[model samples]
Target: MRWFFYFAYICTMETKTSKIFGLRSVIEAINSGETISKVFLQKDLTGAISNELNGLIAQHNISRSYVPIEKLNKLSKNNNHQGVVAEISPIEFADLDAIISTSVEKDKAPLFLLLDGVSDVRNFGAIIRTAECAGVDAIVISKHGSAPVNADAIKTSAGAAFKIPICKVDHIKDALFQFQAAEIQTVAATEKTDNLIYTIDLKIPTAIIMGSEERGVNPSVLKMVNAKAKLPLLGEIESLNVSVACGAFLYEATRQRL
Candidate 1:
């Protein structure tokens, strides 16, 4: 098999993430510096090796949960899972500082896409695909309250997740500060702004921010950005889907940069 992923233990949704079963395999993965998102362990598991795994998981600050053995059995297809399985992120995240450093060395201006609380994996993936297609230099997402770079996100991205550099920031506001320091203008996509997207100068280095599905950009975030712009809404619909709006924003930048 090339690859397969599942989330049998989740009660909220049937979203799938790449997984590797067995305790020793997980330990080896951690030792080899694999991007492990979370680890599921059988309840009441103990002993030296399990203890070692626990220590390693803690040391790396990886999220973990203790579930029933039956849950582990389902996750592992009844195979010997050694009471543990780990979720692995398919794409390795890039460093924001590194991206900024190298982007300045290039001849062309850098284009970055930042997601503010976009939690839907499908939406996140679609935005990623659009950013990659628009020649975005990098994508920045907050570490918490964001969609996982799991199987579904990668699938929805049509493999663009691997092609583009996705950087995880401790907070979206923190990233805005860094972009400002680099002299990259930050633009937020929101309806609150009176300025239209067409008026903004995107020919220079810029980072575009897209907000969550439920709400537009955070009020605090909007305050930090250098400029705020919105796409023209000709219809009665008050808002557009975050992904669709993101495509429009990125392409406008593309057109201006061209």
Candidate 2:
């Protein structure tokens, strides 16, 4: 049974992954209008191929990484990567402005989720799934610190990630400001808050910021949020899993809105 579980995990990790290896193949995939999430290049790569890849990256504004050969090999599963690999995103990212505007146009308040340092793929996926079910307007995540929205994440979300808009920004702080600029109040979920989530009025345009389990929330981000909230705990456990807490917060907002 353990072996079967191991095999299933391996198959899940490898199967249905849209990865293009080798420089030529990656370039071709990009040229074909595929939505490549990011390209990984071997560190110390040089010559015409490297230059060509760089040119294409700049031309298409593609995200890239300079990694060791071992890393590339792992990504390629020991296949012939030829010093390059590109991950294709299963779904398109959403535009934050458009999401807010559409929500307002439909006479619905915008409710978004902003994740701070939530790098666990499974947790991220679960939060996305719950948010979609809760009818969140969109989800915002930092491009650098957030988990990769890969096959596992998509599967864990049960295809909800594709149905919802995922707005990736360079930083969560800036994204929070963008929400405020659009008249959406930013709320942070942290233990520092004595205010219960249900007590806070979530019927208005709102963006809820959830931090990683390791770190409750970035101090700077906590300071910037319009309100801070915490879930009530009856048990001895001091905290809830980030995904679970997020679902609770989102549903509270949903209940308020409805």
> What are the runs in model 1 whose C-alpha is more than 4 Å off?
1-17, 21-28, 38-58, 61-85
What tens digits encode model 2's per-residue C-alpha lDDT throughout 1-258?
A: 976865676477557867889988888888898877778999988889778878998887777889999999999999999899898887888787777778777767878899998989899989989999999888988766677778878878877888899987778998988888888899999999799998899998899999987987899999999999999999999999999999999999988887
Model 2 spans with C-alpha error above 4 angstroms: 1-14, 55-62
CA lDDT of each candidate?
0.88, 0.87
Give the number of the best model, judged by TM-score: 2
Per-candidate Cα RMSD to the true structure, in Å, reads: 6.2, 4.5
Instruction: Write model 1 residue lDDT over 107-165, tens digit each, in one string.
Output: 99999999998989899889888889999999998866788787777767777888999
Q: List the residue pairs that clash in candidate 2.
A: none
Q: What's the C-alpha lDDT at position 22 in model 2? A: 90
